[model samples]
Structures are given as structure tokens and as C-alpha cells.
Target: MSWPRKPLFGSIRARLLLLLLGGLGTLMLALFLLLDFSIDRQIFGRLDATLLGRARGVVVLLESHPRDDAWQELHELVPEYATGGHTDFVQIWDAAGSTLLSSASNAGNNLQRPPAPVPANAPLFYDLRLPDGHRGRAVGLRFAMPGRADEAVLVVAEEREQVDQLERRVHVALVMGVVGMGLLAALLSVLAVRGGLRPLLAFAAGTGPDGAPRVEPLPVARMPSELRPFADALNAAFARLQAALGRERRFARDVAHELRTPLAETRMAVELATRGAPSAQVLAGALASIDRMQRCIDGLLALSRYEAGIEQAQVEPLELVDLLRRSLALAATPAGKREVTLAASLPDECWVMSDPALLERIVDNLLLNAAEYAPADSTVQLALITSDEGCTLRLGNAAPQLAPDDVERLGERFWRKSAAREASQHGGLGLALAGTLAGLLGLRLHFALEHGVLWAELGPLRPIALPESPAS
Candidate 1:
């Protein structure tokens, strides 16, 4: 699928920063919420304990004697007992359920008793609404005075909206802190992410000017652990690119060298034909030069396409023996000129599935290469080995010039024999292209000298599918 060449607001750097900071913001907000709840619970617990203590103090004061002046000291000591401007409010009821005593702080409000009979000395804490339209907490108890058997119910209550409001303010501040931190973290994260990717940016500069090697490679030593693999891969690719550039320049130079003679001859002939001096011969020479150039160009293109694709477009089952015979026939006149004889052993027919043009090219290159480099008056052998598994085409040529070490470089592009023993017009793309063709055709191409005879073999060919049996 194709995407827009450039999309707005869709960048890896921006997306990464967003994801990183968003996750952190969510985590921070959750922690802050938990913290708010924890703090609120702690504050409310402490406040409830304080209110309960004040309620107990009031209970203690009400049980004491008033004539001993202790009540005055009690009023001085206890906040709820003193009553004015205090948050704590108290109410007491006699045995008949009459409102007996109430704190000035109550403002005529009281905690209601439970409808059932009260349990003695038991205290219950509950939430209630105050007369002033605020929420309150109340502690109620049913108890008798120090000497009386009849029951009295006492209550202490306080407005809680203020503490609740304060807690809300704290929660708001915490939430604001989360928001502020989120923004700060996002900004910092963008900067940090950019800084973290700096080395990668430096590692990835534009490719050097076309058809040239890079001046320098990326610094692998300084790359962080996270990006080391990426750096290594880029370096590897750069190395391959550099090698390809070198090979391309060499190939071009070889092509120019091969074409110079033909192109010069063609130019001279065209000039002669223009002068009307035996135009037909000059024209024929020019046509031959053009055909030579066309062949070289075609070979280069075929090699390139083969390297770039695993399979050629038009593939079919090729008859290996017939292709081999045709290639040998084409090589015979050249071999006869060199006084080199051709020998062959093959089946009546051998079949392998491959692109026929590519197959023909490989066979043609192999036979011609053998004929070109083989010793004059020597015999070049051709043979094909076949089985139910696969087929291998072999070409054996007499190559007295090739050493053990020289054999290894035979298929390298633009490579030639160390000393030019004969005048041959061809560039050294034949064997290299043969190798590429073998790869594209799913065959093996290699050379070895057994008793000073160079062998160029291509196969085992692509596997032929076996026929399926009918259902039993």
C-alpha cells in the first residue's frame, strides 16, 4: 500500500515523545490521585480522633460535681465545655427524653437518638446535616451521671464542611501539580528525545555525491547500546555501496575500453562512407561495431536484472542438451579458428525448468569462454549429468595459462588473464554474467582445474516437480 509522501504531524520523533510522556503523565496522575486519597484518609482519621477526644472530655465534665469549682476549671480546660466560638457542639437529654442541657455552640441543634432502646455507655459516631446547611460528624452516647440509675443521652457534633473544603483545596493543588508536571515532562521529554537521537542523526547523513564512495563512515564506537545494531547495519550497507561503486566504475571503464576500438572503426568507416569510398564495406563494418556494442550492453543489462530478481519473467522447461548443442555449434567456428577442437557427451534430451533466454545465455557464455581461453589445438569437453534429482552442465577447457590461485578469480567482473596471450575483442563479463545467470536460474556455477583442464559447470538445476498419483 502507498502512503502520502509527506503527512502532517506524523513523525516518529514526535510520536515517540508523545507516547513516552503520555505514559509518564498517566502514571504520575494515578500516583497523585492515590496520594490525595491517602492524605485525605489520614487527615479525616486524625480529625475524627480529635473530635472523639473532645466528646469524651465533655462526658467526663458532665459526670463531675459542679459545687467544687471544678466545673469552672473544666470550662477553662475543655474546648467543648467552654462553648463560645468552639466548633464542637454538645447536647444532653434526661431519662424522660427531655432536652436538659445544650452547649451554646449547638445553636439549638441536637443529635437525634436511635428509635430502639439505647445501650448504656455505648457511643455511636455518624454523619449528619447541621442546621446551617453544612455536613457534620456526631458522636452520641447513652449514659447515666456518676450516681443516677436513670439514663441520659449525650451528644457531641462538629461542622465538617470546612475540613472537607480544605481537603478539596489540597486535592485541587495536587491535580494542578499533576497537570503542571505533565506539561513540564512533555517539554523536557521532547528535548531529551531529540538529544538522545542526535548520534543517530549524525550517523545518517545524505549519501555522498552520485557514483562515489563516502568520505567517512559513521562512528560506531560512540553509538549507544540501543543504536549499535542500527549503526552496524548502516556501516555494512555503506561498505557494500562503496564496493558496488568501485565495481561500477571498473565495469564502465572496461566497457569504454572494449567499445573504443569498435567505435573508432565505426567512426572512421562512416567518415569514409561519407566520402563515397566503398560505402558498403564501411557500412558493414559500422554495423558489426554497433552489434558488438549492443551485445555488450545487453549482457550488462541481463546481469543487472538477474542480480536484482530471483526469477526471470519468462521461464519454462528448457531442453538442456539441445541448448548445449546449439551453444557448441555457435562456438565451433571460433574454436576451429583457435585450432581448438570441441568434444561433447550428453543425453538425447535433458530438461530443466528455467528462463530459456537466461539458460541460453549461460550455455553460450560457457562454451564461448571455453573456446576463447582454451589452448589452441586442445580439446574442450562438454557434458551434462542428469538424475531424478537434478541436472548439471559441465564444460571442460584446456587453460594452460590459469594457475591454482588464478582459477579463483575467473568469474570476477572485468577480470582477465594476467597476460593477454591472444587478441580477443570481448570484455570479461561473460563468466561473471554466467555466474549471475546460474544464480537467477537456481543453478550452481563454479570452476576447478583437474590435471590442468578448466571446468565451467552450471547446475544442479531447479528441481522438477514429481507427478502426483491419482487418489486411491
Candidate 2:
């Protein structure tokens, strides 16, 4: 059976807080455990030492006096062992396992014996239940008596209730301290996380009413070092978005401006037909205006399709020379009307890989644009230049009116040299569409005006070798 997945924390701030608090809590718990263990060890160590010292004192007394006077001296030297209220106890046993002396605190009961084979010089410390029924710690020692060859075992024990109580108090204090530090750490973590994310929050606040990003750039300098790269990326994205929005606005304005004249012309022509003007003339005007509008709309749609990746190029090997001739043939009528000559420099078969339809549109637009703009009786030159790398199609014409700087604006939509719109039937979208289609075909269109001639160069289009015939 599959188990349901747990939902993760959504907010970065919450995640960071949880991580910091969890790590700090674990560290504090470990520190508390370490300190508690060390403190407990130290407390018991001192208790064991005290018991050993008392046991050693009893042994010293036994060694100093003769057998007859040893017990009396031990009673005098260590009076606590004789008192009923005392917690300290001592027991001595002979080599033959006979008890010689015990503390009065034992109430005739003996302390538990140490394990067998106790060390001779070093004391052995252990824990046991005392005769008085209290938890206690003890030390065992073996020593030789004065004027005697036999060794005796001496055990010293004390009730550890007070030490355990102190340890409990220390444990409580440590718990309280750790809890306080954990709370403080959680607070600091929250503050640190919030402070670190302040820049991102500020960026969110800068968004527009429609939830679009504002034009103002994000403040990268004030952000943390780790977030600076993120901030820079966001800034760059916002800059591009702003540029795109600006372009869209300009495109809308230009489209409206371009269509307004034709629309007015169409409306006027319709009015004249209603008022009984010549039917042929009125219908001709209306049809011409409609045609211009259709062309503009079609160009806009084609450009939009290519830009949006809705139209993909289907590349194949095609003859560039034949394509150029077809484009020139199509532009012949317009060029002749403009009194411009169409000239071509061609090779027999220049094969290049490109989408045939898109390449045809590019050539047609370039030829039409040149024919419309070239001065009367000027020659529009179309050449196919081939090299080891690939082929470049160069189209040039006399552009005495166009300045060097004007070359860059040639591909912009609806851009024209003259302010008078009545002079030209073309909407100036031809070059823009051509450039866009060339890019979609993975071809580069470069414009350069040198010595009063405007040149539009397309390629280095990758050439494809001819397919061999069946006989070959």
C-alpha cells in the first residue's frame, strides 16, 4: 500500500526558522547532556574520595596502635562512626573473614562487602545499599596491622542523598538555562531570517497594481552577499520585461497610426458612393484602402506568429538562385512602375538549407522594399556571393536620401524616412517582417549603407551538397 505524502512548509522564512531552531535545539540538548554527565561524575568523584580518605585514616589508626589499644584509638579518632545520627560508616574484617569493628550507624548490621580480590594499595570504590537502608557510596581498602603479619580489609561508606539532591538541583538549573537559551536562539533565528529576506519582501512590494513588476530596478547593493546574485538576476529580468512592455506599447501605437489613414480613406470612399459619385472610382478607392488594411493585418499576424514560435521552419536543401529569380520576377511590375532596374549576379545552382516558403517571403520583402525606395532609373543589384563557409545574398540599391545612422531603423516596424504618408503605399512593415523571418530560418540579415548605397546582406547560409543520382 502506498502512503500519503506529507506536505512541506511553503514559506522560505518558515523553513529557515525551522531548520535553525532544530539545529540549535539539538546542539543545546547535547550540551546539556554533556554538562549533566560531567557534573554528576565530578560530584560522585568527590564523594568517593571522601570515603577513601576516611577508610585510609582508619587503617592508619589501626597501624599506629597495638592490637589492644587500636579499637579505642579508632573510636576516639573517628567519633562519627560511633554516633547513631551519623551517615558515615566503617567496617573492618580480618584475613580469616571475621568482623573486628563496625560503625554504630549500622545498628548491628554490616556494610555490603566489596567484590573478591580487592586491590592492596589502591582503594576500590562502589555503590551499595547501606545497613541504614539508604543509597550510599563506599570505598574498600586492605592494609597490614601494626605488630601483625596478617592483612585486614576496611570498608568506608556514606549516604549520598545530599549529593544526589545537589545533582538534581544542578539538573533543573541546566534544564532552565537550556530552555532559556533555546528560546533566545529561536528569536534570533526569526530576526535573522526576516532581516535576510527584507530585500525580497521589498521587491514584492514594488509590484504594480496588476501584479506586473515595476519599472524601477531592485536594490542589489543593500541585499546580503548570498542573495546579491539572485537580486541581480531579478533586476535583469525586470529590465527585459520593461523593455518588452515598452516595445508592445510602441507597436500598438504604430499600428493604430498606420491604419488610421486607410480607415479614413475607406470611410470617405463609402460616403462618396452613398452620395452618388462615380461607382468605378468610389469602388476602386475603397478596394485599394481595404487591400492596404489587409496587408497590414497579415504582416502583423505573420510577424507575431514567428515571434511567438507558432510557426516553425521546415528546412531542406533548395536552390537559392532559382528562389532569387522567382522573387525578382514577382517584383518586376512594381520595379518597372517605379522606373527602377532589377539586376542580378547569379551562379548556376547555389544550394542552401532553409525553409523554402520563409526564404521566399524574405526575398520578396527585400526586393519589394528596394524597388519601392530606389530612385528613378537607379539599379537594384542582387548578388549571390559564395565562399568556403557558406553563401551570402547581397541586395543593394542607391539610397542617397538615407543617412548612415538611418540603416539601424530600417528593420523597425512602420519606420519611414519621409513624414508624408501619402507618398508611399507600403506600410514599412516589409523589412521588419523580412528580418523576423530570416531569424526564424536561422539566417542573419545585416544592413549597411556605404557611399550612398544601402546594402542588405543575408547569410552565411549553410550550404548542403547535392544528393547523388542512382547511377552514381
Instruction: Using TM-score, give the best candidate's number.
Output: 2
lDDT of 1 at 41: 88
Candidate 1: where are CA atoms >4 Å away? 1-29, 53-89, 94-98, 103-137, 142-153, 158-195, 205-251, 270-287, 307-317, 336-339, 372-376, 386-390, 401-409, 412-428, 449-452, 462-472
Compared with the true structure, all predictions reach lDDT values of 0.75, 0.85
- Deviation from native of the Cα of residue 206 in model 1, angstroms: 8.6
Query: Would you list the clashing residue pairs of candidate 2?
Result: none
CA lDDT, candidate 2, residue 64: 77
Cα TM-score per model: 0.69, 0.81
lDDT of 1 at 439: 75
TM-score of 1: 0.69
